[model samples]
Target: MAQPDVPDCPVDALTAECLSRIFSHLRPADLAAVACTHRAWRQAVAGEEGLWRAHCEAEYCLRSPHLPAGGAASGYKAAYGAWRSEFGRYGELAGRALRAWRLVEDWTAQHFPAVAASFGMGASEAELDAAEQQLGFALPPALRVLYRVHNGQELQFDRLVDIQRTAAHESIFHGMFGGYSFYSHLVSCRMLPLRRMVKWTRTAHTQLDFPRGDKRALFAASHNFNKMVYCDAADGLVKIACVDKENCLQAVPADAAGDPARDGALRWFEAYAAALSSGAFAVEALDAENPATIGICLFPQLPPGRSEAVTEGVRVRACPLLIPELTQVAEGERQYFFAYSIRFSLLPEEEQAALRGTLAGPAGGAPLESVQLRSRYWRIRDAAGQVVNEVRGEAVVGHYPLLRPGEGEFAYQSCTHQREPAGSMEGSFRFVEGSLQAPGREFDAVCAPFRLDVPDFIF
Candidate 1:
């Protein structure tokens, strides 16, 4: 058979628009290959922000089925709506401040019962007066209202952990056991069933060891309790562990032998439990002290386009955003931006097979071949749009063994970092003959550029 006349011009001869239109018809992986062809092809694809947005939208919709459409637009709106409904506007500032004041008032009343009785109403009233006299600063309007409505008391978890078995075990085997064994760890803490309401008391303290640096210690305290809060979406939950003290002690260790230290620690746990039961401590204060708490709630945004199936199978559309602003607790202090990739599977096996066959290989199977398609490397740009960080990489593709008539699946690997915010990767594969022969042919792969954004922590 005579081969079609080779074009006089190079593949780069195609116009940018014409190239993009053709590239768009290819699968994402194939389109990437096209970019590796040359600088011009890369520029055509790299300039398109819409492509990245489409990927993000598809992932979001898959993860959050209840979320509305319009992709990222709908997802963001839904997240904001939930935030407002739960905490109200300016909730982060006002709600936190108000909650803090209420907690302080309650703490004063419980620890200073004598003074509280003198004031007739309780310690909260006296504490408020003392704050005004000492700080010479009036509480904010919202805070004052919150204090008036909520007399100081430890807020209880909607549920608490049951420790009856743990308490019994401790009482029965007091002297025989010095510390919890590995197998008995969860049982000793009464955490086996993973109950939502059960709470266990444990003491956590820090010890400064000369060579070892600062070592933090955590042990089951006499009356302290920990609650488990779960999040099905994140596939994990946070445990809110708390403790309190009637009078501050210098310090104590879990393995301490001295009766005085152990007695003081136990007393503190008793008081802490009392505070929690009586509603003396504020939940906001505890949360602020442990911002990295696993219990903190997270709200995720969804992606664009509804699920659809073509001859190739189902296509899931999603969009993901990289919010550098939320990457760290201290803004701009962190090196990497935190972002998530959104993905969803929409097609059945039959459709997926059809799509793969149409997209994977060249038109005629004259012993399959491979080729390079596209590559895009980007640099971090400054405010004025000057490239700052030099980022580069290439994409390639090539022929492989044909599948048996009924076999449709193929396996390949790509190395992409799940952490680094900026960098590039590139490489190529060559054909091999049985044993050790060379089949002088090669193919190209595509490298796509993307940025990471940290999603919002709504709760």
Candidate 2:
């Protein structure tokens, strides 16, 4: 419900520099709310580049400080626009955003308790009324409820890099705007070094390009970024536009289908929530880093005379990959479970034709069109180099599948048990084919030797 309006009381009395210092502590969403209050307040805090950029980093989870590829020169606002576009590429975005935000909230509370304290508790009815009156507009129910949850965050140190490094870090309470009863009081912070910042409000009619008689105005301004988030009175739809010092505002549509949510304004509160959960707001998934994300080199050893062998004129290739899940491991016994997928793409033409003909013509000899292995076996060795176990099975996953040329993938689950903490496993799939000329022909598809070791912690 942050809309363009004039600040009437206490905020009107403060000097622009004083206002900026106080407003610097407010959350980005709160800052957006204040941006519409008046020209002076907007110029003080909403115009600062560092403010918007910091807000972007903290809200979007953006790990990189430098502008992302194709980021707008307008700074955080354009960066946010670019960021929203990137989020559209992900699947199950809403679910991921919610889960990720929950993780972020937990992490902040545990690791950065002082900063976490900035996330304010909900506002009161009077406070909501005050905010609404200041804007000369009715606050939406969702937006009112949102502010009630957290009036605004305290100052964000991670976002404001140029601030007093030692002092800001040492005094966690300095930038905080706690115990403030009024809406404008929430916008004021005292931690920053005071200075003049640019104005984000539209002062002249020439700056806006909305249709004649259109009542759209800026509710949120991207600090130093030449972009503004506005509310279109025509539809109550939140929207974003590029700002040019010399030119008029230009609306930026996010989706080809012209969906406003895709452009990043789902709703005032919903957009704020989306922004809070977006990948751009929180780039680091967790505080700890995983070494596996970098890279891993495997040097597995194979047993002698245990390699793959295919008959002449009958070409079939099996390339297997294993995915191990710690949850799949047995607790009582030292057992490891893994899902494996092997792709068969190099079957000979004659073999493929024979296989297809067998599957398509009629169910005659073997009804194995969906199964891959007729028989399979695995050999496991302990860390001490002793053969710990051997497993021989008929039909992987309880079925024998016929593999097609260049288009077939076989998947199955396997379990290996060992008494030792570490071990190695290697196996082979025995594929049996029956043709008109040759009744029974056997071929071997080798599974690469892979080592397994339990980690200290599952996560």
Best by TM-score: 2
Q: List the lowest-lDDT window of 10 residues for candidate 2.
A: 178-187
Segments in model 1 whose C-alpha atoms lie over 4 Å from true places:
1-336, 339-387, 392-444, 447-451, 457-459
Q: Give the TM-score (vs. native) of candidate 2.
A: 0.31
lDDT of 2 by residue, 259-286 (tens): 3333222233333233333321221111
Error of 2 at 31 (Å): 14
Query: Which digits, one per residue and each the tens of the lDDT, describe model 1 over residues 87-196?
Result: 24323333343334333334445543322222111124355445434333333323222333232222112112232333222221111001111111111121111111
- Each model's C-alpha lDDT? 0.28, 0.40
**Could you estimate the TM-score for every candidate?**
0.22, 0.31
Which residue runs of candidate 2 sit more than 4 Å off their true CA positions?
1-46, 58-372, 433-441, 456-459
